[model samples]
Target chain A: MMVVIWGVVKFIVLLVLLSVYVLFMTWFDRKVIARMQNRVGPKLIGFHGLWQPLADTIKSFWKEDSIPRGSYRFLFWLAPIIFTTCAFAISFVVPFAPPIKIAGGVLHFSVVNINVAVLFVFAFLGLASFGVLFAGIASGGSKYPYIGSQREGAQMISYEIILALTLLNPILMSQSLNFETIVAAQTHHLWYAFYQPVAFVCYLIAMFAVSAKVPFDLPEAESEICCGYFVEYSGMKMGLFPFAQYIVLLVMSAIMVLMFLGGWTGPFWSGGFIAGFIWYWVKVAFFVFLFTWAWGTLPRYRYDQLMDIGWKILLPISVLNIFWTGFALSAHLPFF
Target chain B: MTQIVFFILSLGTIIGALGTILCKNAYYSAMWMISTFVSMAGLFVMLNAPFVAMLQIIVYAGAIAILILFVMMLMDRRVLNNKERFNPQYFWGIILGVGLFSDLAVLAFKFRINITNAGKSLTLHGSNTKMVGDVLFKHYLFPFEIIAIILLIALIGAIVLTKKDEEEAR
Candidate 1:
């Protein structure tokens, strides 16, 4: 019973932390993008628009709720719910810091640490695409939204292969799927990124594609499909799509850090939980910033170019990298 | 708690399967099928096969269902609604259903249905993912390679079939 209570408490804390992170991340994204474009963004609200996301949330709540005619009302209501749930579900397995020794037992920073956590994260990612598909299908049989969902489905399938293959390099080297084990393995040797540079680069590129950020944001291409699957969504229903997206960005960034960046362990010193917690977030923040940075700098890839990059380039390279990593590990090659 | 979870998942699986068949819309049918897949994954997890459960979600609910949904999107609703109620395929469906039911019935009656340590050999010391990896790469290496080769052949065949002819392209 105590254990259950502790688990619930930890989950609530994580929820609060995630909400705060998302709120600030929106501000950070806007500010960074604005600076890149040589303009000030949301400066009037709080300190550099720190409170703007909160204001936006309140405003969205007050807006009139509208459902399109001929829409599947039940599914239209359920789509964002599914998306947001799956998005938050990915974070459940990501360890924020190393487990800390307490009075009676150890306390893990993550919500849950299942054995097949790597696969679990990817599974949720796959399931989240369903939410996008449902939104498109439930939107009164609209052409644009349907096209957007189709693009999302294709993009997800293409990039997921690359994402899985790239991450397999680290998993192979570590010989474990658990985040804690992977991070622990890194502590003993150099980070996987230093050895598996190919996988790291591929993962970085695939990360942008999987998260549907700029360059690969073809699913939600503003000019082309007009915000894609969520074109018919309005009010908080609309808000939920980006809400889920920001969480995905944070979770993917966290996974990248955990897998490749030697999660929570500082380069100079492997410190206590307090220091490790700070180190972990700092790394995660860099990746989060990188997402917005890419958003600001890069132009959207044409649909054909997106497919070409995912299939023709990234897929072959990642598959080869996996084979190379496996051979190197077995051969006891130096720096593996 | 375990019983409650099992009951919920089992109920969900039944409802999803029923919905898949009963839904008039192809899109809703696909969604219901996905729900069934997810519930089955939960059941797999309860059976201590987390790896298989995750694979089920990733492969079936994620990839295959999306492909089915895409195909269904191109289909006209008028054509779908105009379809005959009864079909010749029902004969095959009944045969398959009865065969599966009898197989399950025989297993239940003969084996007494207690299945502890059913997958012990496949999951010894390490987690099931590791055990599965060891089995695939070490014990069943040749079969694994053969499967990979078959998949590669299929992939190539798909490309060949889909590719535009040179004369048509010109």
Candidate 2:
């Protein structure tokens, strides 16, 4: 019963948080890109276009949802829901703030504090690619979406290995699979990032690739594929894809904070729930801003280049990082 | 209640196993396989092996399913049209599968395995995870190290197989 109730509450909270994050991510992307281009962006809706995302959301809700004729109607409808649900579910084990006291004095941080939190996150994120593949096949588009889906599938599989191996560094250091316990371990010493900088770099690169962010967004390279897997979607149906993207970003950032940056272990201002929440959000926002900056600076990679980087560069580096981390741990190094 | 949950999960596993054999499309077959893995994981949890259950979900359902999907993506779509060759073999496979399943069912029903009434609480001190870790590092350390070495060799072999052959040819 507690599990069911907590699952429901977490679902609602994630839905609301993801919606708000998607809204602001749009605003941030547009505003940042516009500033780069030396032009104004969405200054009409409210003060400096603060309400622009809200307006856009309302407009999308009212727009007609179209299904292309002869498409696989069932998979088409099921794709986004499956994708978004998996993306949202990855947050169940991710601790956002320190444990908070509820009405009955019961303490909880995450919805599901399972032992294998890190593995669960990667597994769910990997499942999310199905949404893209199914959407592409269901679109009844020519060969482009199929090709795009293939590319996306391959890219995700390649990077997922690196992502898992990179995370193994911290898991090895902490010697625990629970996200909260990992964070608690970091508090006793220095952050994992300090000792495992190479792993951190590999993790950051893999995160971008897994999330399909800039330089690795070849799946939906606008110039080539014209929205790729979601070419046929419009209005609210199309909106769910970006919404899932925002949720992925949020979840990945939260994982990074927990695994590497010492989640909820910042300098104490008041040493309460509010302080922990503030620090958590601050770290997440900083990473999100870094992603935004990446979007503005980097050009998308070619398909072969992306694969080469994953298989050749990132995978080797991550393996080496694991060895280095193990050696350091055994040597009783003062780095962390 | 536990019996009801086990019955439902076993039913799901059987249905999904049948679906994997019966489905025409390879993608659909993969999805059914995933469903079977998930249901099997549920059975693992019911047997008080949460770590094993989670591993079932993570490694098999997650990683292996995705790998199969990748293989499916690489296959020629025209191969899916060759249904005539698959029908006979699929029938035989299902017959053998059901026969094995029933034998296992009979064995499971006959045997009464004793589960020690230890490590039932959720305390962090002596949970299954801690015990498993301790046993793994202490008693089974050499085998664990051997497994790591084997995995490393497999990784290198994969890299070599997938590498370009131009330099070797020269």
Candidate 3:
């Protein structure tokens, strides 16, 4: 009973922290993108728009929430709920820092430490796309939203293969699915990124594609499809999509740090839990910034082009990388 | 506590399955099917098969359900509304259902004692994923490789069929 209660308390703390982090990322993304475009962003709010996300949250709550008359109202209502739930679910397994010892027991930084953490992330990642697909269909069967959902379905199915295959290289090296074990394997030795650079690069590219970021944002291209899947959504309903997207972005970045960047453990230092926690977020923040930077600089790909790049380029490369990793391990090669 | 969670998940799975059959909209039916898949995954987790549960979610709820929804989305509403009074599939569906039930009944009767022993052995393993890996790669390597080859053949067949359609369109 005590263990269960402690777990609940830990999960609650993680939830609050995740919400605050999402808010900060929203503001950071806008500010960074604005600077890249040579324009000031959200300066009228609190302290160079540090509180912009909070203001936006309040404003969205006050605005009128509308459901299209022709839409499937139940699914319209359920879409964001499911999407947000799946997004937050991925956060449950993320090890924020190394385990810390207190008076008698050890305290883990993650909310829940499951053995199959990597597969758990992949499972929820797939379910999140389901919620987006549902949003497309439930939005009064509109043409643009329908098209957007089609793109999402196809894109997720393709990119997820590469995502799993790329991560398998790291999993092979570490010999464990738990995030902590993966990080522990890299603590003394080199990071898997150094050993499996091909897989690392491919995973980074697939990360953006899986999250539906700028270059692969065909699912919600505002200019082309008029905010695609959530076009009919208004107020907080619309806000929830981007909110969920940001959480997914954070989760993916954290996973990238965990898998490839030697999560929470910097190469230079051997500091304890507090430093590890800070290091984890610092690496995550850099990856988050990369997403926004790409958003500002890159152009969105056409639907066919997006599919071509995923299947033709990323798929073959990921497959070959997996084989190469397997061979290297069996042959007892250096670094691997 | 475990029993309570098991009860809730079982209820969800049954409700979702019924909803999938009864829902008028194809998309809504697909949603119910996905809900059913997820509930079954929860049940699998409770049964100490986290690896299988995750694979179930990733494959069934994630990939296959999305494909089903993708096809359903493009389908005309008129096509979904069947004018016939009878579903021809009901006969075969019932027959197959009864056959499956009888098969389960026979297995239950035959392996009632062995099932308990198997359950105990399952809990003794340190890691379910590693155990499954060993079984697949070492104990059942031939069958596993055969399944993989079959899946690969199906994939190539699908691509070849699709390529022909694209060329004809050109």
Candidate 4:
């Protein structure tokens, strides 16, 4: 009975924590990016701009909700929901920390501890592209939006192949797709990054492209495409797209840390929820910082150049990484 | 709680499937197709086959639907909607679809009635991903290899068909 109550409490707590984290991250990004460009971010709104994200949310809520004439009503309404859902869905299987043992029960770190967590992550990542596709095509015959959605769709599909292939390197090495098991495998063995550096690099590149971050954000080239597929969206509807994007950024970092950088484990890490959670999130934060740094520093890739790298460069490297991992295992190699 | 989830997902799946055919715009139809695929993935999760569910969404909903959406976008949008949503074959199509559904229903009920237990029974024996991989590699290796060979031929055929001759281009 207490366990059931704990489960409910945990779910609510996690949901609230995620939302608060999202809020803080918006502020953090603004501050970081501003410092990068020698300007103040949002310090005027509150102490260290703590309430800026909340204020922005309220402002967006009051903006005019306009739908393009001749727009397909169902799809226009559904796109943001799908996008948000897809972003949050992949986090369901991700274990947050070590399972904490209570008086009568155990508290697992994830919402759903499914056996196929890795596959689940990739699947939802793929599905999320449809939200971009629908948003583009259902925008009442907008030309630029159409172009944007096409690019988003093409880029997602192309990068996904390499993403899955590179993912298999860790999966093949660990011999499990379950995140919990994978983490445990890394707990015993060294971190996957040390063992499979090629896979790590391939995955890192694929991750940027798949998430449509800077240097790979061809779908929404704001200057040329006027923000691409999401041009027609306005108000809080527009708000949801970026919210979903932020959530995905957080989730992707967590996944990267989990798969390659040793999930929830650090030097001399003992079994305690607080310590494990801190280590896990600290690593996740480092990766998120890397993403933002790249976003601030890098220029967007040209269209053909993006596709060329995805297919010609990343594809071959990812495939060879798999083969290398396989050979290493078969030869009973001593080193990582 | 499980029953409620099942009800919602099944309703969504049915509506999505119908919406694909019923929508006037081709873009809407493709979007509905994605909805259907996503709902099917949810059902797969309920059935304890997360691997199959994920694969289903990734391939059908994500990749293929996007390809269709791209094609739909390329064509003139003005002609995508039909003046009359119903076609001459609509009646026959419904009849045939219902007949096929009923036939499958009959077969399933006849064969699997004894195995039926709870109204919402979902069973699983082992690791769904591992089991699938093992079966394909062990039991279905020959058929899988043959299919791979056929896919290779199709790839070659596609290149040959789409190739442009240098003389013709000049």
Compared with the true structure, what per-residue lDDT tens digits does model 3 show for residues B39-144? 9999888778889999999999988998888887778755764534347878998899899989999988887755324322245444589988989999999999
Descending-TM-score candidate ranking: 1, 3, 4, 2
- Error (Å) of candidate 3 at residue A219 is 0.5
True contacts kept of 4: 0.82
Listed for every candidate in order, the interface RMSD values in angstroms are: 1.0, 2.1, 0.8, 1.2
Candidate 4 lDDT over B55-158, as tens digits, reads 89878887788788778778887776655678788999889999999999999888886433322545785567888899999999999999999999999999
Comparing 1 and 4 on lDDT, the stronger one: 1
Clashing pairs in 3: none
Candidate 4, residue A326: the lDDT equals: 89
Which residue pairs show collisions in model 2?
Answer: none
Which residue pairs does candidate 4 place in steric collision?
Answer: none
Report the poorest 10 consecutive residues by lDDT, candidate 1 chain B. Answer: B117-126
C-alpha RMSD (angstroms) for model 4:
2.6
TM-score of 1: 0.94
- Provide the lowest-lDDT 10-residue window in model 4 chain B: B113-122
Per-candidate total of colliding backbone pairs: 0, 0, 0, 0
Q: Write the per-residue lDDT of candidate 4 for residues A120-160, one digit (tens) a residue.
A: 88888887888888898779888898899889988998988
TM-scores, in order shown? 0.94, 0.88, 0.93, 0.92
What are the runs in model 4 whose C-alpha is more than 4 Å off?
A1-8, A103-105, A268-271, B1-8, B82-95, B105-123, B166-170
Give the number of the best model, judged by lDDT. Answer: 1
Model 3 has a DockQ score of 0.79
Candidate 2 per-residue lDDT over residues A1-336, each given as its tens digit: 777887789768866776787888899889988898789988998999989999999999999998889676777887788789888878777877787767976466677778878877876787788888778766754566777787888888889889889999889988888888898898888888887888888889989999998979888889998878888888998889988988898888888988999888786673678887888889989998888889988888889898889999988888887888788789988764
lDDT of 3: 0.87
Q: Lowest-lDDT window of 10 residues in candidate 3 chain B?
A: B115-124
